[model samples]
Target: MNSRITSEIFEATAEPDPEAGLFLNVATNGLAVLDRLGLRERIVDKGHRSPHLIMWSSTGKRLGTVPNGPARDPERGSVVVRRGILHHVLRDAVREAGIPVTFGARLDRIEQADAAVRAFFADGRTADGDLLVGADGVGSPTRRHIDADAPSPAYSGLVGLGGVARVPGLAPTPEAQHMVFGRRSFFGYLVRHDGEVYWFANVTHPAADRDALRAVTAEEWLAVLRELHADDPYPVPEILRHAAGELGGYPIDDLVHVPHWSRGRVVAVGDAVHATSPSAGQGASLALEDAITLARCLRDAPDHATAFAEYQRLRQPRVEAVVGYARAINRQKRVTRSRLGIAIRDAMLPMFLRKAADDTRNDWLYNHEIAWQGSPVGGRR
Candidate 1:
């Protein structure tokens, strides 16, 4: 949601900077940026602090993504935390900064007034705000209220399984032994903060029986994976063979279009407006970008209407490009077929990676910064 990128698109121009880590930084630091701006707080809870953070590996190997400081992984490109965790962190921060929170208080409706957002809740509660950001996710009531004709999210024809296990850290070789099974499926190995090993598998499935998936025990999942991936590379079978407890399975979905992101005083962000397939691993990053950009535009615009216009103006094209990329990558991930399909996939991966690099290079999303003005607090109300 950086204006640099947004403005470039509006002017039919290209971004000046498109480094690999540009958007990655914005995604990871979005909450931290808001906290630093005094709009939120830095929270530290004992059991689970950031619920939305997903430690993963795009290739599904010992290459799982973990939180890092200044140094970063060179080969995996950019890394960002999941959206839920980012939201939790920011919510906690905002609370500490004197913003109240309404949990389990689902929004039933959002009605825009001349100068404020009148949001009604399921429990018949309501709140008024000069600006409203719909980060409520894929089935966002905010989006529904704003645009009843907004397109619904569609399945991307891919499903994923994620799990954590304790393995011989030295045996698997987190860096060296992390293996991939080509285009068939993705397998990963990760080391948790508590020294537990973690792994995830990206598989293509036509329809997911949620109950059947969760009903199976971890050992059962291993057996199923073993049978499905008999022809895969070495560690994939081995990793699943050693999987423990319940394995997690989830479907991937994409939202192709949303007519208008902003209408009067309400503006949707993240999956609320442009939910995307996970194949591109940009969902969280995109949401983080939305949060930062929304804050920046709302602060800069002279009025709420202007701010909403600017927000949509800045986010639409970039989000559309990203959504297209996610769908395309999902097509490759969902391939399960003839020898011809296998051969084409085998040859297309490298080309795909190269094109991905190029596409990101011509964008400014990676260079976003959460702009904070005034006392880093109540400058805009």
Candidate 2:
């Protein structure tokens, strides 16, 4: 089927910023989908191979390691890349496939007919097609169009901040990313072969005070981060001190459940439907899974209604499961001032990690494979 993409961005250029600090950890499952589209090599080439996540405590003690993805093929594990570079690669791939893209076409409303759907943009343009997919994200207008009472994104009680920095003589973290649960916040970093460090911190903040948090200047935020990690470890402080450019900051929000994913010819995908916290590192991978599954359902089902139902049936359970898992991790990252609580968490985390590593608990997540050529799981028409 032919498709068209519309973006609110004023320009069609993919690289919004060459030095954008935002990064994504695309798991093996996500890479599998890219491989199916013949774009895996192109995307992975621009990323660092991150195969394991190593956790540390505020006192600099190792809290065991968890495989970033499945261990079946070590080479095909998770990869860390700047979000802008990933977007550029995918944008190029879409262009190469001859799919037309319209920029600055923000959706103002959607009109649906029995046999077709029409999208009205704020810029006085309209596009008609057999279906309208809402990949617009957490603040999706299409979501409300499908169901007026759709649930709004819930703040994850964490304000995320990060930036790229160069630390002279810093050793590269080969095939791994380091995470530290600090006294006041949670920090993660990965070093590239070129000595450039990609780091991010999740600070515990009240959801009601998001606006106040946003009002803080970048320099002030950096200073707060430095003090948060000052007594934690060596590199955490050093990385924040040398952070380059304007650091990116945003309130991490997620949607665990949405009553309706589709109404008529319009359907939501990715963050528009079910968004997860970055704690589990499954946001991008789950979205890719949705794309592959939805395409197969559309191809195999007899009609659009059947396709949409089957797509939701196949996706909702898995998506909700992952979101819940991420929420659990987010709770662990929440700052605890009580010394007893902190001691309990530090002691229990190692045991939990050991069990998880021994049993391959995340197999259901990273080992998921999309059967593109197979018929839809449910034989409904």
Q: Please list the C-alpha lDDT of all candidates, in the order they appear.
A: 0.55, 0.83
Q: Clashing pairs in model 2?
A: none
* Reference-based TM-score of each model: 0.70, 0.93
1-381 per-residue lDDT for model 1 (tens digits): 233321100111122122211111223233344445553233222111221222212233222222221123222223332233444555556656565554556777888778676877777777776666777878788788888888888876666665656655424232321325344565544443454555566677777566765676757667767776666655556666667665656666778678888788778889988987765556766786677767777667767677677777777787787789778756656656676776665555545443332243422333344445643221111
The TM-score measured for candidate 2 stands at 0.93
> What does the lDDT read for residue 251 in candidate 1?
69
Alpha-carbon RMSD, each predicted model:
10.2, 3.2
For candidate 2, lDDT tens digit of each residue in 1-381? Answer: 323334222222333565664798988888988998898998788898998888998889889788888754567679999888887887788788766676657788999989988888887878888788888877888899999999998988888889889998789999989999897899999999988899999998877366687688889889889988898977899898898667767888889999899999999889999999888888888898888788777777778788899899988988898899999889999998898888898898888876544456677778788777654342211
The number of clashing residue pairs in each candidate reads: 13, 0
In model 1, the runs with Cα more than 4 Å from the true position are: 1-77, 80-88, 169-184, 192-195, 208-223, 348-365, 368-381
Model 2 poorest 10 in a row by lDDT = 4-13
* Worst lDDT 10-window in candidate 1: 5-14
